[model samples]
Target chain A: MKPILPFLLFALLLGFSCSRQVQRIETDTTIDLSGRWNDTDARLTAAELVTEIMGRPWLERHVSKTGKEPVVIVGMVENKSHEHIEAEVFTKELEKAFIQSGRVRLVQGGEKREQIRRERADQQNNASQSTMKQWGLEMGADYMLQGSINSIMDAYNRKKVIYYQIDMILTDMETNEVVWIGDKKIKKFVKN
Target chain B: MKSYLFTLVFALVFCGFAMAQSSDQNPRAQQAYEAYAEKADNSHAASLGATVDKTYEAHDPILIKEQRREDRREFRRQLRLERARRPIIQNNPFGYYPYW
Candidate 1:
């Protein structure tokens, strides 16, 4: 029993030493473990897409016609990847890029818009008359941005390749015309 | 005793190989990374002025929160700098001398 106790202690120490260790890293640093959809992919996609979308001629045309920055509302971004990818991660980054560009104007949409409307409705009855927000005065969105993410995976034994494509489209709300289309493709290979 | 030593050496060698393999990147992945870096650099160069000069009309709550967090971090960093710059005082048992 005494001999076994020493061996057990050593094994326990080894196990503890081998335990996983985590270290905080810079957010922009690209660290791919499984080579799947990750934060780096989302960030790069958002940056590239914003750069491409903003450089396009459609924005200038819209501004020339309207004499004002185009107001945009973010719509759904569907994820059709092989893995369970949170589509909102990429969408939120894209939304941030659009808002920061100063060239485009973004309006509240989805549940937030509903919440604002509810607040306005509540204010009508319970709030003072001078400061109450009036209904129908909200700035309507001129264009709606929507997109989809798709991925293709090819694996053979210990070797694997993943290809992800993000496609975004902006459409005119009034005319139902597709104003702009942008896409970014990322491919990664892994071998175990 | 010989068998135990052999097992220990085998385990150590295996761990070494595992560590080496984990850090090894496939040639294709390396190529892809190079291409991605190049494209990113080109895109950044092309959109430099536009991105820098652009202005937004509305503020997203998330962005505002991030800005506030950054402000707090900057304030903490300034406090740390001030503390670091402060001179340390040593007490002399004999007297409160400036040299001490």
Candidate 2:
């Protein structure tokens, strides 16, 4: 009976210690306990890449030549990284940057663009003539931005050093000329 | 004899409740949260020209919704990473998860 009392007391204390806790924290709180890739990494990389791609000489040159903002379409990003890193996520960040900077125009690509086309086709047949958007009036993309996500990892016991390198290239679609290059490299040392 | 046992049980229950209350007042957790909050406040002041140390309130509802969504995503990602790090407990050796 004495042992039972002590055991029950200990169990009660353990339960209290192990109780799940919820704490509301700041959105920007940088909590990288395991540190694979996190929101902080995504956000900082996107912001930095945007600054790099927008502040370059290509924007001024293109604007001076064309007398208007250059239209850019995000092309396919190849993921050569070990992890299943979605390339669209990074590309979408770049697209958002282009619009926010007001330096360039963004055009949808891939399935989304085709979906819009399908809708336009539907509208042409089903809707009134005045409300229908013209197909041929679509703005042609002046440049295509593409990139790759590559990573290198070194592991020894419970420690690991992961280095991710994202390389982006902006090319003039007409001339196939490389205009701007944006590179974001992140290295993290994670200990388990 | 019955009264002693009842007293013991009641004492254990009370102790547990007290501990649960104190757990939330964890110093380390509070410090980390305050550090992040201070940084966010500073950035807010510099960017939006808001008064320093004022509790942040988003003027736009869309911004608050987006921030909450992003924070939830981050929390889920951390949980997933933590789970992945744990050793497989069972005898199944195929590691059925393709990506793992």
Candidate 3:
């Protein structure tokens, strides 16, 4: 009877455990990731902005189709939202879309470029004569992509309304000319 | 005491299985939702925008409701598929690991 009691208690514990919510693991979830991209909400907003920008036939016409394309770099994207939303998620998606479409040339953005240079320097110094000695190749960006995300929030205690607007502008590196612009917005409300 | 405890455990197991099975269906509905959203944005821009604004004002929970419904359907479909493919266990809720 005592042995049976132990087994019964063990069964109860196991059964209880199954009803609990699954534990969340530390992984990218669209909103919290840094360095590479922003959270999910920001990514969705960015994708919308990309769609808006691509819809502009006039902007497409202006973008030069030189056989030897100029490098394009991602510049600062300001977060003007109510919450600490990852803004780079928009830029990263924009960069990806540009690359995938095979429409524009892209250069390594921000710190990633510097890291590549540093790695190449180390390889050139340590590797033998047969190794590729290329480090910090001479490349200049023709345009810089920049953007911002802004939001407004109105809440009366338990009830709340949120509005998000994301904007992106592409500028000529040499002439400082604004070439293309895109924007996306999202509005959400919560109540109790 | 054992019979009552077993019944409670069985109920809990069934509830848990139901919840897990239902969760799997959300992705399918979500895909449908995305298509609906895109079409709405394209075809009826002004009206859809107004609708979206109104829903956002209320923090639209349509996604949540749809997801729940989807999960239930998927759970049922999965059970049907499983039954068709394999033998059923009639007596035990936890046939393999009863304690757990």
Best by TM-score: 1
Worst 10 residues of 2 chain B by lDDT: B45-54
- Candidate 3 accuracy as lDDT: 0.64
Pairs of colliding residues, candidate 2: none
lDDT of 3 by residue, A1-192 (tens): 678998999999999988868778654454332222235566677668778756665345555444454457777666655456555556677778778877667877545655676778888778787875674465777777777767676656555566777777778875588877888777766565
Please, what are the lDDT tens digits per residue for candidate 1 over residues B19-42?
A: 897666565987887898877743
TM-score for each of the candidates: 0.60, 0.59, 0.53
TM-score of model 1 relative to the true fold? Answer: 0.60
Per-residue accuracy of model 3 over B1-100 as CA lDDT, tens digit each: 9999999999999999999968766568878878988776433222210111111222324445668999999988987777777666567666642221
TM-score of each candidate's B chain against the true B chain: 0.33, 0.31, 0.30
- Backbone clash pairs for candidate 1 read A102-B55, A102-B56
Which residue pairs overlap in candidate 3's backbone? A30-A39, A30-A40, A31-A39, A31-A40, A189-B59, B22-B71
> Candidate 3 chain A: worst 10 consecutive residues by lDDT?
A29-38
Q: What is the lDDT for A24 in model 1?
A: 93
Off by over 4 Å in 2: A1-19, B1-100
Candidate 2 interface RMSD value: 20.0
Model 1 interface CAPRI class: incorrect
- Candidate 1: C-alpha RMSD after superposition: 34.6
